[model samples]
Structure formats: C-alpha cells, structure tokens
Target: MTENLDPREGSLTTRPTAADRARALLDPARCRGLVPHDAGYLQTAGIEIPATRGFGQQLMRTRFYAGVYQLGRPIGLRVASALQAPGRDEDRARTARSLRLRPGHTVLDIACGPGNFTGTYGHAVGRDGLAIGLDASHPMLRRAVADNPGPAVAYLSGDAENLPFRDGVADAVSCLAALYLINEPFRAIEEMARVLVPGGRIVLLTSLAPGGRRDRPHVMVMERLSTMRMFGRDEITDFLRALGFDEIEQVTAGLAQTVTATKR
Candidate 1:
C-alpha cells in the first residue's frame, strides 16, 4: 500500500526525538518505514541488503560521515570536473530542470547519500508526495535521517541494483553521481526504468571515460583505487534508448555527465 508521509511542502525539518516521529512511522507488525536512527528505515519482513558498496561509502561511518561528505564532496567533484568539461555547480541546476516535479509525485533517488536530494524532492512534491532514498550504507542513511528529516521523505538501506519497490511506483527516478559505484550499473538502470511509470522522467549523473578510454594509465589507476565503473559516452545513452526512453538530453560537466530522458 502507498503511504502518505509528507506533512507539508516546506523547507527541511529539524531533527526530532525518536519517540516524536515513531508515532507516525512505526507500525507494530511491519515496522517497514520509520526514522533512520530508531528503526533504520525500511527493515521489513523479507528485505535483505546483501550487496556491495563503493569504497568511499564503505569507509564512512557516523563519527565523521557528515563532516566528510559536506566538505569533501565538492572537492572531489571539482577535481573530477577539472579533467573534462570544467564547469561549476551544474549538477543541481541540470537535475532541477530535468525533474520538473509536480505536486504529489513520487521520486526515487537511487544511491542517495545522506538523503540530501531526497528531502529536496519531498519539498518539491509537496504534502501528498513521497521521496524514497535508497543506499546500501548504514552510516549514510543514519546521517541522512539526522540531517534531512521529513514526513514525506523515507530513507532505505538497500542495494541500488536490487530495489524493493513495485513496478511503476515512482513518477521520476534519479541516480546522481553514484551509478558508477554500483557493481552492476546496467541492472540498476533497468530496475530504475521498471519502477518508473511510463512517461516518467529520469535524471542520471555518472562518470564518462575520457574519450571513452579506460585503457589509459591515469584512468586505470583511478579505477583500481576507487572501483568506479567508467562508462563510455554511448554506453548509458544507448542503453536508455533501448529501454524505450526518448527526448534524451545530455549535459556534460568535466568528467561527469547528466542525462535526462522520458520513459516511453
């Protein structure tokens, strides 16, 4: 059954005590979706998240997670961007334009670290909407719950490649700057397409190989260090086309690319 969790269409909410939010989230039998700290988000009856995560995410924990993410993310992006398109904070603008969310829309943010974008999605969707953020890291989810609390937003600890939601559950799907971290990115994209309603749009940001070259020394070195999948230009674009997506638009900033398309 679809849950209506959002209390309003507003800015980020302050962190409340576990007992405060538990009244709305905890169902005695299912306990499926609750606050991240108290119930660890979606710990339902049959769910098991036995999947791999990126080395950086695996290395982060509650102690220093927030600091690292808030401080380090931009630096990393800047360095990566320096290698290719060399633009400033284009991710936020590109995504905001592509999503074009209306009230009550459900947006699934795959690999949503810290639920940052997820909460924004919730605000965009307004009172009768849902924004589900799925990530395989426990620390990330916990931090997210602390930082980005909302009635409309829910965080789940799960694999991006193996989502738990039913088909056509979301109006829009997004995988930002993290698709390359998944062990099976193509499978993850397929699952994203499956869960989205036809005509629903998708926004993706991932690393593209320089001149589609992974055989280069520097690229190989970085790949060995981070275990990030470097995609070719046509790789994801072609895959989306085959998956029956249209109106494909790609915006490149440095080594990363943002792709927006509608599911046919």
Candidate 2:
C-alpha cells in the first residue's frame, strides 16, 4: 500500500545546495520521510528515490499532474525500496555487468528514481567519476539528491525529453525504470543520443507487458489505473537504432526489460 509523507519545506528545486541535499538525506523531516529507514534501503548513502506518479499510472499528463499536485511532505522513497526491494534489480545488475564503466567517466542517469542504479553508477565510477541524475519530479529528485554521496553526485530537475546539458558531455548515460513514463519516448531517445560523446553508452531499463510491446493485459491494467505509458523492448531498440545507436541488445528480467546501446 502507498503511504503519504508530507514535505516540511518548499519544493526540492528551491535552493538546491549541498547543505540542503545533505539535510534532506540525513534529516528525515527535511524530505518528509521520503527515505525508508531500513538497513537495505537506508544504509546505502548514494541511493535516493524520486517522486513518481504512484504505481501503474497511464497518462503522462496525469503522472505529471500527480507529481505537481501531490502536496505536503513527500513520502520517504526508501519505503518503496523496502517494499519492492529488487523489483527490477536483476535487469539492473545485468545492465551494470555488461557496461564498461571506468574511473573518471562522466555518467548521466536520466530518471534516476530513488538512486537505485545511481548508487550502482557511483560505485562503478568511483570517487573520480561524476554522476549526474536528472528527473522531472521534484520529490523524487529531492530524495535522490538527498541520498547520493557528495562530491561525485548531482541531481537536476529536468525532463528526460529535454535535458539541460551540453551536447556530447556525458561519457555514459543510463535510465532506470523511468523511460516508460515519458510522453515522447522517441524524442527522449533522441535527446539521449544527442547528449553522449562519440562511443558513449546508453542503458535503458523499463517495465512493460511481457511481450516486446506496450499492450500486455496486466501492464495495460496497471497503466490504465496509474495513467502512465509503458514501452516495449522492440520499440525501445528500434527507436534507439533510428536515433543512431548501434550494438543494441535487449535483456529480460522478472517483469521489466533492459536495453543497452552504444552510440556510433
């Protein structure tokens, strides 16, 4: 069941400094109990959960609207992590295993909800590497920002379809469990393609119907209820290829699929 946590301060985007981020992560009241107070969820210093449009949303507008209207202290994100612990963890592990991340690489995590993979990226990139997380939800970003370890981590409030960074700036880009929420998935892929330097990598992990499309009954039911749009593996790969991504491969997990692509 979803729990409601209220925010004690202004929106997360308001005055996002290291001090604010630190407080939000360490001080439970600052983020309104958004981080779960558990060993598995809370022990990880670099993990943060971004605010999502609840579970199984269908419409992008509704998801965005839900993000905008949901008031009060945001629920601790670690709660979801504790409940759905490793929901899509296998896919993430698989993607992480395949990627060739090195020290000092500049990594960008689009839609880095709750800092799950963000934590993984932090581990992979090491202290020298820089990880930038981008998400549209303030609560989510706030929680993620709060959770991430300092120095190598930074969270930005922006849409995946419209990233606010210089072109060819990232050495690698990864999006975990967030692309399906985008209204224009193709456009977002284009943006991802545009942001990476030559030979930069992209990893996309998303949940959808069992097939390679977005029309599974169970998933459809969830989407209708949640008002969110989910995409399929084939569609995601094709979109990436069309956007000039090469060496695209799809890997399946418990309920979601992960796609890895390298920029040509």
lDDT of 2: 0.60
Top TM-score model: 1
lDDT of 1 by residue, 1-264 (tens): 333334684544555332233234333443344333464565433446645555655564345665468556767777776645323335454565588887878888898887767777877777567777877777777777777767677777767776766677688999987888777889999989988899999999889788766678888887878878777778888999999999998876668877999999
User: Of the candidates shown, which would achieve the greatest lDDT relative to the real structure?
Assistant: 1
> lDDT tens digits, residues 46-141, model 2?
334233554532222243533432231122212322333243455356556656678777787887755556666777777567676666655555
Model 1 ranges off by over 4 Å: 1-40, 60-63, 83-94, 215-218
- Which pairs clash in the backbone of model 1? 5-151, 6-152, 85-254
Error of 2 at 72 (Å): 21
Worst 10 residues of 1 by lDDT: 17-26
- For each candidate in turn, the TM-score is 0.79, 0.63
